[model samples]
Target: MASNLTIGQRIAWYRRRRGLSQEVLAGLVGRTTDWLSKVENDRISLDRLSVIKSIANALDVSLGDLLAEPSLFEWSDDRGSHSIPALRAALTDYRQLSPMAVRIGQEEPPSSAGLASEIAEVWKAYQSSLYTKVVERLPVLLAEAHHAERFSHGDARHAALGVLGQVYHAAASILTKVGEADLAWIAAERGLAYAQESRSQVVTVSLLRSVTHALLANGRYDAAIQLTSDAAALLDDDLPKATPDLLSVYGTLFLAGSMAAARAEDRATTRAFLAEAQESATRLGTDANHAWTAFGPTNVAIHRVATAIELGDIQVAIDIGPKLDTSALPIERRVRHALAVAHALSLWNRTDEALATLLDAEKMAPEQVRYHYLGRQLVLSWIRRQKGKPSFQLTDLARRLRIV
Candidate 1:
């Protein structure tokens, strides 16, 4: 008699058949090898429906196939037209309907083409939404499309690479904001690799910038500066005069270098880098002549405020912060809130006020808020030690944010 197999056992068998080691499979699915192992061994359960779908897709099996027992299938009337192929078809149908299923209380029928288009549309919307500096939902959308197996063909693979790169970049940013620098670094590196494979020079440049940002977040100022310089040099000027993508990339790199220099306390170098960024921003036009038209004056101003905060020039940060029209800025690039709050609190010697500002920023987006909070906490801790009591609420905020 054939033995009954749990989902974990089925996953293990299919994984081995696909000739993928746990580590390799885990990387593809953005999971840790240990977690995959535990799931395979039944030591842990797959509670998230998304994880289950991802596993099924990676194994090229149906959810039912993974759940079915060999002996029971042979003995049941329900076995008619219930081969792996049929089960796979059904699984595809279910996965395609996932997004709609997640929305209203209605159960919609699935369409392969419709699912692909929906995924593409949602991905574009997510990218657009990044400018608004809001993105707690991007990761979920990317993961859903990833598990839906909506990206298997050549064109789909290219799209997947682009989506995955953006997802990883966003994930890295969120992780860094939450003070998970190590995890952020890993995600950024993975994103950069995928962007390169997609041959999307613009996306690759963005991913590289993200990596530099991660390095800076981790206090690796020198490394971040070096990486930003290298990325800048790699931008080919011959690409196209109308290509704002390359120009936008250069602007971002310059901003990164400026931040790094500020961290290193090199005032002259920071000013020089900021000047370069400003010049690049000025050159960007409304015509299709630029590679990334997204890097406008607002973006430059946002960076200026950030660098000012980093350099401990509270007055400059305060002056520049309000000048920025954040309404035009991307959701992902909204660094002003933390910068303004931190600068005001620090300069006014109102540590309590600064802590509150940081807390407010955190409430906007915990992941993004953590970046400002970490720096503020470091400064506050030193100040508290010098004084009698711990005035700033860094410890409390850190605990609430799960940073400690």
Candidate 2:
């Protein structure tokens, strides 16, 4: 039942369910009844994300609901979705309460160093765009990190707590990617609690970034921007003695804020945030992935592209996005930048080039392209615009993404 409807049809369904008149819905989205009538009848296409987001907001539905994302999640090949339940269980596991509940194992928890190494492996998998692998690894890793935090002592206990915070950060990151922003928020809040308990400023700042991301994903743009700004301000006093990891996280915070500002259409604020990030990038002096941030000069540039796209500066996105050398970045960042470029190209009406860019990205990270909203939206838009049957390549990609 979910597979056959276009986005317009879905919108109509939701609008009817809410008992909204076309006049009321159109007014809510700042459009006329005639325009919305066309939209509901599939005579118009929602080519811009901002517009679609506005409609989704007006209809009181998530962007994913409008896009029919549940069907994609239910598809057999979406391995990331398959692990979400287990990961949720791990997050809620009662054994983390220690003496209050039955312990699951007799063996002592891994040492701080061992836990760090294991957590780093999960980050590595995530950076490589191996979402399924990361999701699969997180549940047990989460349980073990909790055990380590509970059993270890003194400095070892603090270190274990920091590792536990990082484990939750990873959980939040993966959940956000899979469109489970609410779950990501829960993971991030839990991580921040552990981070504060560990008394590590760096871990706290890093987890704040995760929290900011979750906020942005949930469309709390102003809250996300404020969080980034507040977090960035806290670090400024320590800037004189800041390490590379600290600088990386600091810069990435601004990068995230810049995105939030752009989404809010606050051009001046967006530019200001980008400049702040650029300063950090310049201080870092190279393309580095300190603290798994992938934050550096190159990443700064990538965010510029992303922000430009959000602000409807398609020319700016196309100008810098396609020309940048992101080879030094992680596969996840590289593929993400590629999708940004593809989005810009599609908006510029360079459909062939957009398809080529997406094809190239699919080769690099099939799961990333298939699961990413931009890629899926672009494919759907192109298919809808085709006067006749779409090319076999386009159809195949759509089928694989389960969005046809």
Candidate 3:
């Protein structure tokens, strides 16, 4: 956690996270290793704002991300990460004010279309692994959504609540990625509640899959699978009769269920869900971003790779891994697929190949892979399992992630 770290400690943390030695980081910022060590150990104070900005930029984090009290893995039952506390507090504050009273607090009123576009753009940023930017934008946007909700009763109200739900859902997704599964669930449930209020099947279904993934991440396999199954049962129609949006949602549901089943080693269930997802993909045509989910033929292929890994069938995963056309996917999904392949490679003791796979993922979205708990753990495990002095590639990966 960054809460109590001094500037120097923060620098050291970031440096280690990037797998940089004092010498390496010093070189990047054009300083001596001794000088960098002194700064990291708090021997010298970083008094200039410009210097601080430079350090943060070199680390490829925002000044706020550098200085903010980010809870890397600190957990609260209802709030997993630091972000949840802010969200919970903001939500509590909003609960006290009447909806009408909240409308007056908007910084400036925006047109419905304009506000909708803003929310959409926020989602785009989020799906691209721009978590820092998302965290920066969510507060104002959620508050504005509340304001809009208070003053409108028709389609505008649905639009506003939909945005609010989506914001919470995005929060859940990022939280889950950072290892705060509990907080992720809280955010997801809040999103699902708002989805219900908006009366949007698409939103609600999307949330169901999201929460399912969170549950699966936390090792609640049965609960995860059940959530998707129950959600599917709620839909009054089958895939063939469903709208494109509904089919998309169902496709994601089955894919998530397939993951959970694979984790449970229920091969039968896994293949069943996999088949169903492919069917939904067939119905929807190639990859389509319905319900904000990049569900389609390409995603289906990606999930097959993941399921193969989960089932401990590394060869199967290797065979399917090359068929992915992730260019059509959001960066987040692309990184996920790459990491899955990396994991499979690691299982086969293909250490260099695994590192290369992870590097490819980091190239796609550095922040997403670098700070992600699973990827970090994978690299650490790689370091531990190496039979001799680590390979340069392994050391480079570790140094880049700062696990060494």
- Clash number for each model: 20, 0, 6
Instruction: Score residue 391 of candidate 1 by CA lDDT.
Output: 43
For candidate 3, write residues 298-402 as lDDT tens digits.
Answer: 998998888887777779988888556798889988998988888777777686787888988988887787667557656666665556888787688766765
68-182: candidate 1 lDDT, tens digit per residue = 3221112135334333223223223544345344444433333335444554444344334321121334444445535433435576666566656666676566555544456
Q: Which stretches of candidate 2 lie over 4 Å from their true place?
A: 1-7, 37-50, 67-82, 97-99, 102-105
Q: Could you give me the TM-score of model 2 versus the true structure? A: 0.93
Error of 1 at 205 (Å): 0.8
Candidate 2: tens digits of C-alpha lDDT, residues 1-404: 36546778788999999999999999999899999998877667665556777888998888667765522333246453567788878888767755566366668878889889999999999999888788788998888888788787898888998999999999999888877777889999999989988988879889998999888777778898899888888877899889999989888888988888888888999999999999999999999989999999999999999988888888889889999999989999999999999888888889999999999999999888876767776787788889999999999999988876
TM-scores for every predicted model: 0.55, 0.93, 0.75
Better of 1 and 2 by TM-score: 2
Q: What is the Cα-based lDDT of residue 143 in candidate 3? A: 72
Q: Model 1 Cα displacement at 9 (Å)?
A: 48
Candidate lDDT (C-alpha), each:
0.58, 0.85, 0.74
